[model samples]
Target: MNAASQSLSHSSLAYRPDVDGLRAVAIISVVLYHAFPFLLPGGFVGVDVFFVISGFLISSIIFKELEVGRFSFADFYRRRIRRIFPALILVLCVCYAIGWFTLMATDFKMLGKHLAGGMGFAQNIVLYREAGYFDTASELKPLLHLWSLGVEEQFYILFPVIAWGVWRWRGALLPVVLGLGVISFVAGVQKLPSNASAAFYVPQYRFWEILAGSLVAYWSVFHPVAVTRLRQCTALREALALLGFVLMGIALFVIHEARSFPGYWALLPVAGASLLIAAGAESRLNRVLLASRLMVWVGLISYPLYLWHWVVITYIRIIGADALTIVSGTVAIVLSVLLAFLTYRFVELPFRRARSSLPKTAILVSLGAMVAAVGMLSFIKSGLPFRPGLADKVKARETYAQYFENSLPEWAYFSRAGIFDAYRMECDFFDLESYRAGHKSEEPRARIDAGCYVPDTATKVMIWGDSHAQQFYYGLRQVLPDSVSILQVASSGCAANFPGRAQDGKAYCDRSNQFALEVIDKEQPAVLVIAQAYGHDSINSFVELARTARRAGVKRVIVVGPVPHYEPFLYQIVIRKHWNDTPRRIKDNLIQTFSELDERLERKYSDGAGGFEYLSAMRHFCNGEGCLIYLGDDRRTGLVTYDYGHLTPPASLDFAEQALGPRVMANLELQ
Candidate 1:
């Protein structure tokens, strides 16, 4: 037999270039999934490929040493530190340096927190809680790929103890590993559907893939002769390897991001990797493909490649002008490969080649501690928002701080957009709808301690509709002169001109609209303003509501068009294009229908042909550059619409100055 086949056919845990080829497959799969998800949606299963490799290799080492009665935890860890820390520390420091320049304030703050998690090998824990709706997009997180490393490291730390403690008998360890693997696999399958994030991130749910490898390692060490004889059968070896490849192919094509992952789906990659490993180099498939020179080279540097690939792609996306496309992603991948080669050569090789000594381990540990300290300090200082050179980059984030709370464990957008309570205060009713659920005893909630309507003894403008209308109170109060006092009476739902058929507690909406009419009649406001989130065909209803106001003895009626809106939120735009970039295509993400609606309304009604003033909120806020994401040149004016389409205090004030004030100026005689 050839030397290559001789080395691989034994289960002695000798060097195997074919295994490195497997590493190449794993790393490439993960990179492809991250860089171009559409191309290989299930490529993420490559991480399971890695788990099996780690389990077999590490278990082989531990079992060999324990058999000889010479195993030491110190020796095991010193080796682990040398293997894992060099590339890790290098990647982290580079990320820190580059992140300082490119990342916005909130993004940087999150980067800091992730750095802390990665350093502690608790990235899986960090990631599990980070799957909420309001958090930054997962693609923008540079250290996100580290969760797999964190999982591997945790297993390496814990599994060796289990192996050594259970090594009393010649065959004792197999059942323990097998039983644990069964429990982990079953429990993970049960948990995946309901708590997908936890199943994906948690080690307990993941350890089964590794233990499958341990089972292979156990069989190999105990039955090396039998394994060698099995590999010597060319037809059987070819069949086993072919089946492994087929399973992996099915996994890559069939599984996807939408799948409840790492459940039954995990068996494919695990079984595939195990069969390929057991098939040995003698198989034509293993010898010709996996042991090829190119595959071996990529496998040699796969660890660093995995580390570099995602960060490169993510950083480019964080700052790139347009959305990430295949071309840009290809560029990112090429750069990652180059960086990986450099890291593998300069950073990883030197440390790995050195003798495993206490001082060597100590130096690596110290470097890690220093890097962790930098991460911790950055996190404690809130990503150093005060960093000297970053002010220009950070100003946009600070201007919209309420919309970008990066420090919290979960994100809820617009939670601090500004006084939401004021809109519901004493008028807006949400609890009234829940009476259908038999909460009749639950007192309907409306923050009515504060008067629903703004009090004005003389001429005043009253705004009425729903929370969309009421939110205008802050901005109008701030911008309009004190003489032009305003009234805001609204409900949580749409307000009608008159009552509709009421059921359950839905009567509250009609009552709220009636209350607005009552306030309008009692106060006898000179100008009655109607505002709400307008639907496509609601203009007729609005005109009817306008006629209702006129009948209530209103001197003049102003209809406020819908405010500009954004989807998800506005910060996504900030991550891609800073508001200052000329030709930034801020128009891309804006809901175009609102701007069109505003233009159409202004053209149809500015001539007073509709019998009242129609103030286009979109006209004052939107232009050729698209609806304003934030107001003012430096954007210290804050977000125009704090949430999806409700104006902030500053925006409302701006609206009053730009739209309402001009319409009212001639009549009110305000300079």
Candidate 2:
């Protein structure tokens, strides 16, 4: 081989111990973050470190082959398959098996969806559509970590194609790659504010991290002498390497999920990883610290280690237990390590090294088909509800039919179903399409037409607040006499008290409340009823709303207090109760935890209200015996709450008629 070819061969064939050590750092950080997040808040940045390392290593090999006129796309992909597929497929299959026994139908169905995404290398897209990165729901998803793998695989597929194309036009490669990186980084920063989940997971935003590594590869190839000279500068090399380590430390310690990420904040770790890679093994930090035998050992099994850790942690969480105790967490970590080693030794090594009768392409295609088939089957069967008697358990529950009877259609429950039938006749249901398209402020109000629900001469009762107010409408419609008509001016999550104040940086609530206020001013209804789910500022908002109503010429104002809530979904608790025979006292404790807030809000608002009247829903649903989750002795006939807090349609009607109807009527002098 020529000198350049010899150098390339040495670099590609000879493993850099320090690189493995870096892998150790990345994997450890990620595993720790998953197992004990409080210990290392920014451990998620480890994924970024791996991305950079992948970019550097893969690009170096591809660039070296291109320089020698021996680059083969088939060979590149073959190596990728051997390296990535074995451990991944094994872990996925194991996860499917565990999930079958442990997860609920809804959770299993979601797992099936993720399985399909994992097989297709589209897990990131699937997760992005489902929930945000910081969502509590994400912690329960075993396959969520595969999103990083998906991103890396996407990079592998695209980068080689781009690099090969650029190689043909050698002079343009640098400029094109650098320009794309800059554009991608800029786009990620801009998108973080508006669509953080998309910005975090989408390939376009993440491509820059991989490209940063590719740049180092290009530099190493074209300017070998400069790289050599830089390595010779021991002081500079040590400073750079140490500085990179510090940056990584900052990412692993200071950053958190709450921070806007993969934006400027991402640079800290990405740049650190790039600098460490560029510094070479001769540097003091790399030689003494990163290149240690222990670090290299961990690095060797990092891929499989990462694959096993999350599923173990997620399974523990899925069991509905508290966070893992230190001993339990340690055991989980040990188990993951042991499994990773076994998988690496028996599964990963054999597939990678052994020659078979089938061609590599055929083997890959067959494996892909098997994965797809399994995922499709799981999805089609709705996660095979027959497993562990889930179907039987659900069927045996008395409230099974009752649950569906009062359940709103999916769109309506989600607050996307638009206005009620009463308002639909007056104006198009708040123009949902227009509102979604940024024309929210221009969307017309949902008004109740005169003589729609009552006679033209009847008194008008207008209800306003957030979704809690919307929930009251169902009950009010059932109990209100023919002499009164109801007009609902409510939007999901829109607090009536502070229409203009933004929540979570979204202005949809503000605009919706503004429109509701305008409707109240124009209509001048006889009674304005305000209700909201209790939140931090809810009490203050309730007082302010009452004042605003009196000023707007609404004679009577009624403030409805919040209902009971539970930590987990009430349905999940009910399901658990079926299997565990949970004590009534235990159930009461869970109910009390959520009810305390409701009780406090009621006491403060009802006792000291000035002009308007305050009514408590707790009186009907909760008492000394603990809040009613289900009604009727059969335990299946009536469900008081649809979710943890929201009332079912029947329950809403019952509460309004039995608890609220008399009080509201008396206040309006209609009794």
- Which has the greatest lDDT? 1
Best by TM-score: 2
Off by over 4 Å in 2: 1-14, 132-136, 321-323, 387-469, 479-514, 524-535, 538-568, 577-628, 634-637, 640-646, 650-671
Q: Which runs in model 1 stand beyond 4 Å of their true positions?
A: 1-12, 355-358, 391-403, 409-415, 419-569, 572-578, 581-585, 589-671
Residues 207-326, candidate 2: write the lDDT tens digits: 899889889888887788999899899888888899899999999998998788979999999999989989998898998988999988888788888889998987875565335668
Question: How many pairs collide in each candidate, listed in order?
Answer: 3, 2
Distance from true location, Cα of 660 in model 2, Å: 6.6
- Give the TM-scores of the predictions, in the order they appear: 0.69, 0.80
Cα lDDT tens digits for candidate 1, 373-417: 888888777666556666664665554553455345322233354
Q: Model 1 TM-score?
A: 0.69
